[model samples]
Target chain A: MTLNNFIRIFITIIFANYINSKINFFITDYYLNFTLGFLVFSYWVFTLEEHLYALPSFCIGLSIDLLSGSPFGLNALLFSISSYIIHSYRYSFKIFSFLQVTIFFAFLSMFYLGFIHIFMNTANFSYLLIFLSFFLNGIAWIFIYILMNRFKKIFYK
Target chain B: MARIAPGNTPKLGYFVLIILASLFLYLDIQYKTFTSTKNFFNAGLIATNLAINNIVFSPISNLYKLTNNKLALINSNELLVEELELSKSENFLILNKDKLFNDNSELYKFINNISNDYPHEIATISSFDTNLYKCCDNHRLHLFNNSSPFKKGGTVINSTGIIGQISDSNNKVSEVILISDINHSIPIKSNAFFCNASGSGRPKVLECKYDPSLWKESFEIGRIFYSSGLGGIFPEGIMIGSIISIENVEDGDILLNIKSIANPLTQKNVIVLYPNDIK
Candidate 1:
């Protein structure tokens, strides 16, 4: 038996968030953050059926919000908005080159980081961290994209 | 036949979800409508973590220690640490005995009746996210106090000095708002000036903003600051920190950055000084 679409997306995003939080434990001291969960959500939106994604994405983000210390619904709002945007642009992404897509993801991740910092931690916000992580996330998103595509092959098969 | 791309998907549901989420976020942040929910969730999470540690990890570690013959050494070390903590707390009580009782005759009598035994509870750190502590303004710690419950606004101190105060408490654990959290502030004074030093959101740092025109006193680096007892939460004359740097802001205000003397991360156990005990 195979997992349905909702379960697949839910498990994948949860795993991404868990790994992202664990990775942050070691790197946040150095002023770095990786938005692996957001990346995975965007990828799933691009690949899967899109019309029903907004609700599932919202629900999944609500689950994550419950476990996190951030204000309730912050992640849900962001995930819903991101799902909408990525879904709207999925057709365009099909024709874009790999480098352009990577660049787009890097900038999107930066926006996510910046927005969260503004609402959740305005006092400790650092442009230096956001600036540095842009490059770091750019590199990280490439690895995540490739690795996720490999898993996608197994799931689709 | 081919499936339609997600780009062509309907947009109405997404719009509705976004609006719903935004409403929830606003309500939660503005009115703290979900604070009780968050607290309940936190209490449950801490309980689960403690249960896992006690039921699974503790016995596994004990078995490993029994097989390795290191249990005795570990137990001795733990005993020594406990003794050291107790001694440190005793020293604090002795040092502040006079000041803590000067105003409260009833409390003083109660302390005298107790003899040398001080009234304070030792709480162990339950959960702390160093990542948020280092990177954000919310420097909170979950502390487990199995004894009597910790009262909110009670002062929490380690071996060094004041680390924070109890902000919230439930059945399972108490939440500590560290001095370095942006939302926390302590009324502090030096030789010349008095101001409320707010948390800088940086580890072990607090910032005091004052107008240069109103406060003519000059501040220099390394100048010591002490609690002013204005808020009545913390004891007066206790060492808070020292001025580390000064900067002039856009509105002709002077911002003095203080490096706090107490480091919460240095110890696993903290002593909670209830106001009723001291006042």
Candidate 2:
């Protein structure tokens, strides 16, 4: 990646951190729209290469752990596993279209959130939350992917 | 973008890390290592939040000052005039009485009477965990600290009503076991009945287990409950909550559903009670 691309990614990561701090997941409330936003961010991290993305995911998880006052390293483990899954599968899948990527990410995001529900021993894992999270993440990913594509078109050319 | 193949060895390492972190978290929960870590984390978080709050509020505050300058000045002048009138009245009361010295003695006596009611000093809640479970446990520790003048099991409160009893205390912060914890049992009473109200781990709710024979009439919704002061943890007549509902079962047991009058979630300030004789 060029220096400018690297800087753009760094800025995006900072923006995500700020957003995470401002938004409450409402893990307390049974269902909320904020969880969907979290899933979208998680999916974006998942699509990236492991070596390049693992460090950012780790930082994101650490920031969350600090901000949420959860037991240290809880998010670290969850995000690490999610990114690892995406990295492992990234090569086999063809990058046919934005829709395909969105569907793939939605599946992974659901699995990520499902794993958290089981780990936390919540009363019920709202399928609505899971499905809505995927849909929202898909919507967010379109904007991000479009921006990345545009950047690639103008600068990479 | 170039992608690298993941080796089996690194994946195994990640799995091991997950297992190890999970074990640490579980052990921390069971053994309470998280308590100290939570305190340290809270201190940092409080500092950061304060800085953020200042930054965010500064602009709004400045704007308000600019727009409301005349209003604020008028209000301050009014307050000063009221203070002057009150002080002049107090001075007249002092000078007009032949036995003004007795009034000083009476004032001293009043202060002495209230001084013993609260021996331990009040502490501010500087920071709290965003996660409810973590917040609950941290609050429990803050009330329970040994150093607090509150008896091993004495009640804590704010200006409004009872919060929880002193479960533990330390030099800096005391652990407060909230009324919502499963382990808490407070002896409470109403005008017509007395019972032990137990916590069910739900916020703002308590279950009062009363003897069926004690009640001449069935407990109804909206019946107010008060601290019986039988357990010596709380002072008598403090408002607990009104009875939200009641159920009597076939086994002759009675359950009174109570909601606390004071919402602990929104309480930014609290007072710790120390028995009169502690000094």
Candidate 3:
């Protein structure tokens, strides 16, 4: 990676950690842990054409697992699988509609939250949050995509 | 132009990484091996937070404290004034301690009989049915103590004189049958004339029917009466009350209505003297 790309990743990790901490502290009290940090890292890695996804994805998931107080490699395992699937389907997404992409993002978010809910909070986990977060993450993807595009334009301009 | 994506994902590589990650997770959860790692990371995060709090939040808070010095001083002054008033009241209690007890010469002897170290307590009436006290024969009262337990058969007195005895006691509350309860009677002394005065079912009223021919002096109104302590229930020579009326009828019985000095309505807080055997 170039110096510029390294700086971007460093800042994005710090910013994602800050947002994840805030969401867990304030917003995720009774809801699902939105996995904002892992999602941000996944979005950045998947959009880039470098084909070097697994290493960066593992690092991001491990950082989130440490910050989130989950089992050490729980997020790493799940995030790695999701990133691989998205990378393989990236060419297919070129012809996909916006609703189809949103549905795909919703499905991925639901599976992620539901899987963790089964292991981490089995006693009181609500499947309702998994379904609700499916919609929320679908909407959030649009914002994340626009913001990344804006950053790319500013950085490359 | 957008670059072409990778035609396929590396399934074998992904499988290998998943297996490795799953093994790490299994070791973490099953053996808690990562607790120390998590604790170390937590300690680092906490140290970072404390540093930021010191560098960012502390100066702002110090500035606030500096600006609020006048408010703190004002609060301190108010607290000091309240404390001074409480101390003044306590000082008044210390000065007038003797006057709170009655003017009986046998007071010290009576207290010594109860206990050499004086182990009695002061209690107030928590509940007294005034309507029933005036009209009913029971005249029971509930007493509460912040000091010690008021035992059953303990003597109850006020600043003026002996009023009654406690009929029941527990950790929380005690019941007292006042001197005016119809079932109650106190042995009294009046110039070698002794009789048991029974309650008249009225506040501060007790009636004693005696043979007028026994004592040389005729029954006189306003004559002083005192507890003789003959029954071992009450302390002797406590000024109980003065005679209010003497009526002689055809039955040859002298009916006397002696008024009590300690009115339960007037003097609310009474002293309880617990006997040594019941202590």
Candidate 4:
């Protein structure tokens, strides 16, 4: 990658980390999972150089794993799997509606939230959180996508 | 355009990367392999975030502070309320320090007397895991006081009465083991009715069994019990609790339920007295 592209990727990773920490105040006691990174990383996969997707997805996941104190490779594995699936179906996304895409990501995020709770916080885990996130994730990203579309062009391009 | 999708080599690369990630996940789950890495990254992230937040948001934050007049008043009001509570506790402590005893050593005598009184350290509880306290047999309290050092066996007392004793202590933080712990036992006396009360693993209750035939007189309910100082851990004549109930256990022994006066859950601050001669 060129230095300019590297800088863009670095900036996006930092922004993703910031989002992962902040703006989850809506869910009081639940582990606030923002799937913005997942959403944007998949978008980058579909639009950017496809071969670069998995590596940067892994980087983003590793960053999240370190920060969120999850199992070190859990997010990396999930992101890799998500990116691989996205890469395999890159052409299909062109025809899929925004709602369809949002529905797919909602499950992905719910799995992440549920798995973290099962492995790290079994004593405090509530099944209600996972059930709630399934619906809330779709609504959250739809809003975020509308809000951050302008910035995506600058970073993803 | 061709650079957007790598044909064959990168597909194999992604597979290998995911496999490696799986291996790392196994290692991390089985044995925490990356905790140091996580800790190091966390330290760096916190420092970086703090610096970035201060530099980037300080201007807007200052502007918000300048515009909001209510926040300053609220902050001052909160401080004044907290100070008022602290002063009230101090006044209560001063007035009641010697009032517990029928002796004339009130605030006037305590003010001028140092050699006759046992010095105690006042500490605020910084941390207490309530879940662990209730569920587990081991009950412990973490206390913080920077000025004074606490030692093992120091008697911990709350505003109401005796609560626990310091099991471990350092310069900054100390751990107190509550009397309700199964391991703790206190030599208690109630108007000559003496027995070694054992903790029942229940909060505020201690268990002691006595032979009914030996005494021939039933221990009355609501009778106050005091520490007899036989254990050298607690001072003598301090009120521990009252005889709440009496039960008949197996082997013809009568069990006495001693209800403690101090509840650790209610009290925020406690005093730890180091009485070397109390034994």
- Candidate 1, B62-121: lDDT as tens digits: 899989999999989989988887677556645554443324663455456433333467
Question: Which docking band does candidate 1 fall into?
Answer: medium
Off by over 4 Å in 2: A1-30, A36-41, A50-63, A92-157, B1-9, B48-114, B120-123, B128-156, B165-177, B181-185, B191-196, B209-217, B246-255, B265-267, B276-279
The TM-scores, chain A only, for the candidates as listed are 0.90, 0.63, 0.84, 0.78
- Model 2 per-residue lDDT tens digits across residues A1-157: 4556545554555565456434532433444323343453454554444343555556566556555555566666677676676666565455446577677666665676665554442433466766676666567566666765575466542
lDDT of 1 at A81: 79
Task: Give per-residue CA lDDT, model 2, range B70-136, as digits (tens).
Answer: 6577668867875654443333223323322124664345335445664554545554333443212
After the best TM-score superposition of candidate 2, give how far the Cα of residue B209 lies from its true spot, in angstroms. 5.2
Query: What DockQ does predicted model 4 obtain?
Result: 0.19
Name the best candidate (by TM-score). 1
Overall lDDT per candidate, in order of appearance: 0.80, 0.57, 0.69, 0.67
Q: What order do candidates take by DockQ, descending? A: 1, 2, 4, 3
True contacts kept of 2: 0.17
Lowest-sum lDDT 10-residue window in model 1 chain B: B1-10
Better of 2 and 3 by lDDT: 3
Lowest summed lDDT across 10 adjacent residues in model 2 chain B is found at B92-101
How well does each candidate superpose onto the true structure, as a TM-score? Answer: 0.86, 0.64, 0.47, 0.50
Kindly list the interface RMSD, in angstroms, of each predicted candidate in the order they appear: 4.1, 5.7, 24.1, 9.5
A1-157 in candidate 4: lDDT tens per residue? 6667756755665676556545443342453445565655555554565345667778777776775556799888888887777676665666678778777667767886677556654534667867887887778767656655666565545
User: Runs in model 3 with CA error above 4 Å?
Assistant: A24-33, B1-8, B56-279
The Cα RMSD in angstroms, rounded to one decimal, for candidate 3 relative to the true structure is 26.6
